[model samples]
Target: MVRLADVAFAVLFVGVVVRAAVTDLLVPASTLAGIALVVAVVGFSLFDPDGGDHAASLVVHVALVGATALALVLVLTDLTLVSRAVDLALFYLVVLALVGYRRAPLSSTISLFPYLGAFAVVVGLFLLHSLDVSPGSGLAAFPVFATLLLGVCLFVVPRYVEADFLLRFVGALSAVIVLVGLPSLFVGSYSLPFFSVSPWSNATLSPWFVGELPVLRSIFPNPNTLGLLVFPAVLGGVVDLHRTYGRSGSVSLFMVVPGVFLAINAVGLYLTNSRASYLAAAVGLALYAAVVVIDRRAVPVLFAGLAVAAPLVGFGVFRGVVPIDPSNRFALWGASVEALLAGPTLLGAGVVNTSELIAPFLSEGLSGQSSHSSYLSIALRIGLVGGVAYCLLVIGPLIHGAWRFKRVDVGMFALAAGFAVHQLFEGYTLFQYGPGSILAALVVGYVIASVVPEAT
Candidate 1:
């Protein structure tokens, strides 16, 4: 099993790195590259040793490279969902491994509550539409329904897993995103394939055209996604670097090495001009430095308190807890709540057209801003209860874990802080974009794993 596992992992790593460095090499031959990646992820999960030999066992690691590589290639081709398919395949592999071998993933019944809450909201809302729930015009269509369940499932994965696998996944993903994004620094703005030097092809979005100079989106279509993808990894890598090459008194040389790479990532995120991500990265880095300055132990309490309060407090930096009068987002939030109340009693109008749900909310004076808040979007779509469930089911465990790790690891908590802080403005959840969902789940999962008690 060990030898087979080694061979499988070796094949997977070589194949994925190739796929990343160069994409769709098998294009004319079909998406054989994609196929190979999915197969490798499955194989890694099945053959890797039990109890993981690490401090904890996690299933997310099996498909880490596979999933990340697939995502890169798909973007190069201007695609979505194809890479996520690798995660789906890897998940199925985990299911089969558990069924055949009874290898349990770190089970969390508490995580199931969010699922139930979301399910109840979906069901109750749909049923109420038949009874003509007020303030609502029609039920959520097919897209919203798919979103409701799909979002829940995506969030559920890490909650049930061990932390080691998920964190390794985060670190690896952060590195890949940084690598892909580096091209923008040199080439300015071009697709992964970048076949035409001519800018008017309409085939790809060149960031340079948006401005007089290249801002860097790397392989992604938009600067916002690039910022979101690279920033968290930058934060996480800093934390890991300290632990790996860390020493007391003076800053470690090892810290300088990763710092150089982190600087590259920071530059990429900066050139994106993704204001929200830039702000988040700044905050995360500040927290990282602050932890270094102060005590690591205070991170949990401070972060937890902030996380708890951020949602309620009204401030421009905090993603607008309550929309001010006449603001675009405020108007959107008002409309979405109206629609939610009118449509379904508990469940949201389904995941479909959640953005549209707030359309009526946008006043002519608001200047075309929709719901800029992911927090509001969830509550508006899933109903107030579903939103609360998510806060508990998803955010609760991870916050708890971050608090626990405050005793030992400050970096992880700070990275988590950056992620949570940024999402307030941008929708990086699984349902929002490819990397967003994966990163969000793993962030929560790893933190939760940190807090879990070992065998008594």
Candidate 2:
């Protein structure tokens, strides 16, 4: 019955992808796919005796459904796009949590160190800041806060699910992402024409845009959001590579796939030209290399060395590297710090609209305001205490996960470490409107679950 439901879901998903490819209905198609997935999940849950145990794995599932229902109510009543998107994202997270729960073991459930700590801090800080802020601002901040909170919950819940099932599910999902999800991004109305330069078009275009391929922006509203999703998969591939090679024999095959994935992602990141993402990817790779060094793994060291070298080669090829533009980042950071130091009031400037908060301070030449830095953005809206607490909340899980990895599971350790590095530069997980934060939460939950022993 579960297999039948999976098949049905797959068929529906394929239909949505085909429609998205041929029409301008990408958003609607994605929405339909999401809805279909929800129905499939419900059907499967209702029919399967194991569903109860699976449901118990993901506590956040209820919260996600409630959030989605609320968002739907607001949307039917004509709520803002941001509101709708937040709710939709919540729904997606819930679905993912359910999937995780269904596949994982109950004994594996237990809150790991850093993530739990991080959640506590974020909640405490946000509440304190809420006291000082306007009701609207507080409300706006709620989605972002909820995303983080739910994510933390998802990250830990996998521990309760079966490990073998959890790993198989992740592996299969990764395959689908590469095969279907990625291909879908490059074809149809959802297709990024920027990537496909036909001979005729190429001949006519200026050299600047000529060689560049459109990176995978997915269904994300922007490239930055796309980067957030892709980054983790890239790291996961690297982790897989490390594990595969450790098994002995078939070393060449183990080395090849990960190397190719790394190269593809690096090129993708460059094409997106997201400075933050570039920084995050670089940091993530560096951390991975550090782990390799600690593990004394020769192949990884060689890979890391090559990774370090690729940028130099690219710099030479591109010539004239983009100038460092830290001025705006610095200014924003300064303002955020100043705001925090000014007072200890809770309930920050009430869910401050990102744009409104930064409009006054931005230079005329600055293309857009709104704190580009997630940490600063949260701090400005929630206050210093909340901001710091939020940071702690995120960092705590990774730290604990990493420690556990050192003792028990290496693959999960790598994942947590890689994500921790990725978050430093990008703000996707901190945002209110996409899969970035939720995915991060899910990955963290998986890591914690994988590493910790089942509770007695």
Candidate 3:
């Protein structure tokens, strides 16, 4: 039954990817076949209660992958109607899966209060503010809401969805992105029939790099997105290498696959030239090393060195020794802070048109569509209360795991930590429906399941 579920997931996942590409190519037969596969998968899961339990994880898991793929396709091609149709289908499929699993233990539910509460607060504020917005804006906000719903669904996956399946899911997802994205740097085109490139670039972001270098977006909408999307795969590959080496007590042929995978993804990450992602990757890998690679007793020394080095690094950057670019983010962040201070302190403006929400507060000539920071974006959209909830949602697992150190899966926890810091500069956290958001949901859920005794 699990094998059947796995086969269905692969088919549906491929169908989603192909359906997005061909939907713009006007291939209705292929598109309809994809829809049919979705129906068959859902029907198979629903009709066979026993099979449904086995397939439950696939429903949410595939939905997130499908959602991100469709979103990117929608941006690069003319598939508005197909994207909406698939989105609705996947949303309902998840809801139905949750409905079937009505036996969730109270302990599991309570363990996830941070995630659930954050979702509720964000949605509540959004609804209140969206009520006053125009219909188009309200419609635009639906995807953000949908993204959060799918992310939280990660926590409730049935017991039948084993850890092995989860590991395979992360590995496969990373492999696909890295394998495809790396080749795209040389072979893929950003032109019509393949993709319609957005005119966005790092050059436009700051005066410091006006024409210094070209941004490598690869198959993604932007470099930053691509960088963030590849981050988890790198972490996962690292964990695989460590475990393989530990089992053999030496680097062997078994370690080569993960080593190569990590190296490729790391290269891809560097090519993206996304500084935020660089910081996130560094922070996550550092934590993984501290917890898993280094002795626990020596951890304080390592952190103390970092504490001393951080101020020196900052001072160097401040003194023009590092030549790093701020990318005008300070202005954007200031505008958001100003708007938050102006009014609507408790329940913020809304998730829709967040850039537009802060535009009024921007200094005379500065411009941006987002706060560029997920933490700021959430606070700007749902207010301080929601921001705190989100923080807890991202940080609670790490804290709990650290407190009960023996039970923690440090690899998963470090991935979550990377995501937590990644959001400090990027907006694809709980409120955004992108690849990063989905990965964040999966990693955090896996960490919670790892640490909490009752959750497993």
Candidate 4:
């Protein structure tokens, strides 16, 4: 029965990816099929009274149910674009559920400090953003909160499951992402109107043009949406390389696949002209390389130098340098800081509509949509207090994990460091929908599991 469920889960995953890939061509079919598959999987687990008993497993089930509830609410509320929200919530829940059931922790589940702390910070930011603004801005707080919660869940589940099981699932997910993304490279166009190429044929528009390469949001809706999946694959590949190398063969091949992914993603960002992703990817790679060097002192600086240079080379090949536009980003940051200093009440720009509060003060060209900076976005929506707390909540565990496992567990440490840096540019802590959120969750889970000596 478990094996049958696994098969169904895989089918559901593929269906989800397919729906995203051919959203334009098969909206009704993809939507119905994907939604049905998710319902089936959830139903199967809930009805199976014998479905394992473990804290991690329980967490997975609860998370999935919570996500499903959120999706239903969004759809009922007429948020059509929120289909991706359903996809993301379901995917993480499934991952955690599978990992948890397979492992069934031998000891009590480790402390929830990592998850709790992250949640507190997110809440604080939401409150801070509420000060001058209405309380509605707090609604925007969900994505970041969900992202951090999911990360905590992922990191903890692997402690009970066999490493091979986790790797297999991750590998399968990676393959599906690649399959979904490949079609976008050739077929149809996906555009974000806010950042679309002007005076160009709509046929030429694609997320790859804007630097959202790998998962191919153009095939679906948003490029950053796809990044939710791709980011985790990158981390999974890193973990796989570590595991595989411990057994045998040249680690070089393992490194190449992730390298290619990084290259492709970097190019996508350049094409999209998303400076934030480009900056995030550049910083992420640098940090990952730094972690690698710190672990394997024998690796020559030449190899390290090449890793650093590869993205620049790829950028030149794919998209020539575009003019930099920091005006809006800087303005948002400045305005958010000023708003926070105005007072200490915690009412945020009401719920989901922060734009109304921002429009009056924004520059001519800047849209009040979102402050490009995740930090500023949180401040504007939640407030300075919430923003600061959120930062600590997100980073504290990674810091704790790094300190606890630095000497003995290299893989987890590297992941924590890589993610920590990635957050600097991309709002991994802010959005719950895509690969970034899942990756953050996985990293947190992995860190918790790795640091717990008994579990390791």
Candidate 5:
């Protein structure tokens, strides 16, 4: 009964995500169903007679549920800051759920303190800034909050989610994204998460692919966001492909299925024509080969493919295939760095303040978009101390557990490496609050969990 209830809740959560995306893109929905499901999960989590006897959880459950209920009311009432408050409520529920996840004692957490503590300092600075400068800018804490979610999943997942659960979740998510998005590319487009690229209410986003060029986004707002969302799944598919072949040139179900899945995933990515994503995939695969089992046969072919793909992508970028010019990237980066230099050296600039600093350098008065690089974005938002702390919070665990990279741990390492590389130029997986980064955070934690423990 516990397993059934948990699966139901997960399924409903995924459904809510899909519906919410569609609602945001096309027609607006009340979103009351999403709230109803959240409420239902709370009930199932606490009072199911056949569920596991978590006798000590009653108080925590009640408090979280009460807070969520209150947030739901506020969302309906159209309170401005209530959405962030609701997010906070949801975050608390996730923490309580992870912490209370059966015989997993506090001791399982000893190895996590340094990383968490470092992140805590970053969060402390952000919270202080959020309070001091833009107190109403509750949404500004997204990057740190996303990082926190990833940390919790990383520390608690090995104790809770097993191999089968992870595989199914990743597989299902990839399929849904690919299948649903493939059709939209050819037929029409919808509203994006940030804003529309097309003048029409239901047209493809800016520089959207046409004919041979797909420019697909699936459920996300743009092709770039879609690329990040599918990256981990692609990595997993590659790992499985390597795992399937044998020394005797043997063929197995494992090799065939994963190869097919990856081919499909690659098609989805290729159609997007996102250069950063292409490079991100290569970075991930390289780290995977270095740490985990290396398929001597796959490396050369993969390299050859990357060689061909990279130059083509670069040519496209040089030719102005994208709406944003290559030169503007440098301009944006320079402005961001200057703002960081001008802001507080130690404690750093306030959350969302970097946008204000950069607006003078941009047209149309753009503000609050990430500085294209997570590293720069953090340095721009917080001080050097916070920046260092944020880096340690995200990458420190992998460095500390470097020795643990083996077998499946390679996949996690590869995923982390891809995300690391991508953040150098694009920062969604590292810094964002949209639907694209939502799943990416869980991927971060799951990968961290896989690599952090000796035999996990």
Candidate 6:
């Protein structure tokens, strides 16, 4: 029994897709694949979460996760229209899905203060001149706000999808991505025609190198981004493998396959040589182990330990013991901070303004100086208040969910925690709706949704 909302969503989705196709007749095959995926995922969003145990719901579950995974992978490409379409469709779905749903109790609704407050503050700042918005920054503004909207959508859509299914799909797809890209180590580069590997068509040695070795970005825009995308697979695969081991008490195909994929993800992460991702992997796995091996009580201890160690770790980075070259990151961060303070209000500089302000700080001949840290990026864009709200949006639910410690909850919490940690080093977490941001939003949304009480 389909609801009226289903017909409405389908009609609207088709209209949007057809208009997009008309606007860009020369769209690549991968773009089409991405559009199809967005449709499947969004279309399946209409299903009630209670139906998740049924066979039809099971198929829809796989389709939604599979479509989301593939579409996100395609997001790394240069397809503008598909990216826009995905953002719009996601926002619409999130808004429409809220209709007819039971409201959470006041306590649960109040838990949303961080998210709502942050959004309101940012928009208020934008509407007023509290934060400066640069001319021709619509490109930056559109995606940032769109990403914020889709991030909320991820939270809503999970009310209708199985978080467990998402983990399994992530694990399976991570293995596939790793396996497909592994050959690049020997072959120098790997890309198919349909992939439309940006800047050049055929495979070529990546201009970027990690300590003399050509980094393996594979299908992603950079090695760090690839590592960002693959680390979740490690967590997802672990969950699947753990379940298989617990159920059978012996090796089985389910165990063997995920095990192999887990290894592949490890190798993939290694190939990227991303220290940030490596740290993220370690942090995520440690959290998972703390919960499973020790107790949920250990989760807070681990976080406390990490917090204490962060400053000491900075000392190592400065001393060169960490093997990380600051790569002028400190300079960029400092410049961003200075500009943020120079603003008229603590609401901070808007997106384009922040980026443009930091440009001159780059060393001569260097350009594109984005705040490499997501935390810093948010601070620069929306100031300390908004940054705190974003942090709460990411971490507050993890703390609440930590109490439950169910399988899906634990796996997603670990995944979301790791992604959050990754943001300390990488800038692609919140404001960017690209592959890494999309994956993070989905995982974090699931974690938050799993812990939140649902309407009947």
TM-score between model 4 and native: 0.57
Residue 130 in model 5: lDDT: 51
Per-residue C-alpha lDDT of model 6 across residues 337-430, encoded as one tens digit per residue: 7766776336666555456767766666546767788877777776777677678767766666655445236777788888887888777645
Candidate 3: count the clashes.
0
**Pairs with steric clashes in candidate 5:** 348-383
Q: What tens digits encode model 3's per-residue C-alpha lDDT throughout 181-252? A: 544444444454644433234442322623333455555667776676667777777777787687899979
Error of 2 at 197 (Å): 12
What Cα-based lDDT does every candidate model obtain?
A: 0.49, 0.47, 0.58, 0.46, 0.54, 0.58
Tens digits of per-residue lDDT for model 1 on 312-370? 65455236434433224445666766767776646665544565676665566653455
The C-alpha stretches of model 4 lying farther than 4 A from their native spots are: 1-111, 120-218, 249-275, 291-327, 342-350, 407-409, 427-431, 453-456
TM-score of each: 0.61, 0.58, 0.70, 0.57, 0.66, 0.71
Which pairs, if any, clash in model 3? none
Error of 5 at 300 (Å): 21
TM-score of 3: 0.70
Model 5 TM-score, 2 decimals: 0.66
| Top TM-score prediction, candidate number | 6
Off by over 4 Å in 5: 1-20, 23-109, 133-152, 184-211, 241-259, 290-327, 361-370, 406-408, 429-431, 451-456
Clashes of each: 9, 35, 0, 42, 1, 0
For candidate 2, write residues 104-177 as lDDT tens digits.
25544434444444554554444444334443443534543354335433542343333323333334443433
Error of 3 at 404 (Å): 2.4
Q: Residue 133 in candidate 1 has what lDDT?
A: 29
Model 2 bad stretches (over 4 Å): 1-149, 160-221, 252-263, 296-323, 340-345, 408-415, 431-433, 450-452
Candidate 4 residue-wise lDDT at 60: 56
